[model samples]
Target: MTSKRRATSVTGNIGESVLPLVAKQHLGAINPLDILPLNASSTAKSPDFRVRLHPQFPAAFRNVTGLTPNIAFNYWPAESKAVDTRGNANGSVDRAIQQLGAYWFGRHSFEPNVVGYGLVCCFIYRGTRINPLQEINFHVVAPASMSAQTSLLRRVRHHAANGGRNDFLDELKTDGSQSRRQLLDV
Candidate 1:
């Protein structure tokens, strides 16, 4: 009988490989996904990152009486500093990443308890044109308090450890903003 050779698979998942990096560097910071080179090509459909948080969060925000989650994330960037709108930093279908970063990243007094992980979930073709998104999508857990030092990765990890699915999706839906428009006005 002739013996046949066994073939080993050489596939890789970018999301799977990138998860740990996100958890370590961006712990508790807003928008860890933006930092990573995530793609939404045919190979990958879901967001590159996801922060699982407890359902019982937003106690403080909830107590605000009339504040809504949608309004908070969508318009808050307008009040504070805006992200880089240049073609290099802000590209099409990638503005979400910047929004996430500007919200919770470097905007806290203390660190958040969270862990992040990323990996390649799909096999990328060799020489495949990797199209960089305009604003890469960033998955993060919303923070308890707003400060300049709170780590988004740590917050997500803590939420995971503590049992929560407080995933924050950051992306840009529009192009005209106070900060971004200023650059255009110039």
Candidate 2:
């Protein structure tokens, strides 16, 4: 007897394909090439998309920082039952945070010229047979900084004081005004 293969593994692939289209439709002002995958790999650890600051961003901000702020988008599809657990949201958020941490501390650690890095945790869920909407959540782990910026220092101090948990990002995610597309604008 022939058996059918399960669709669990391909859910993320589907999300990867669909998210760029969603982004293009919603974020038409930005260049489509910027919203691209990190690499050609299909590994689970790879970030789904990376969006760089558009040229239209505030000239002063870009000049002062001397680095274009970028956001890494990580897609987590909820339809994959094999990976979906009761604590899936929490797990997914943690994983996204971990990936950002790895990038900041690993590849970009010594890059003094680099200014800021942001991360977006995208949760793609099917609300109906014909509707699949994504809940895009974001956190600015590394705020933009010029030389001797007190704000960046203050953020570091706050994170150190709070035992490294970013309550601010959590609060931002809870605030309904900041949508996924809006986060990319930063």
Best by TM-score: 2
lDDT string, candidate 1, 1-186, tens digits:
012222467454433453444334433324543233334345323344433222222343344322223222211211111122323322422333343333333232232221111111121212213432222222222332332113444443444456433233221123442222211110
Residue 51, model 2: lDDT of 48
TM-score of each: 0.22, 0.42
lDDT of 2: 0.38
- Candidate 2 lDDT over residue span 99-181, tens digit each: 44333322233442222244443443433334433344333334433332233334334544675534433422342422111
Clashes of 2: 0
Candidate no. 2 TM-score: 0.42
Model 1 vs. true fold: TM:
0.22
Clashing pairs in 2: none
Give the clash count for model 1: 63
**Each prediction's whole-model lDDT (CA):** 0.29, 0.38
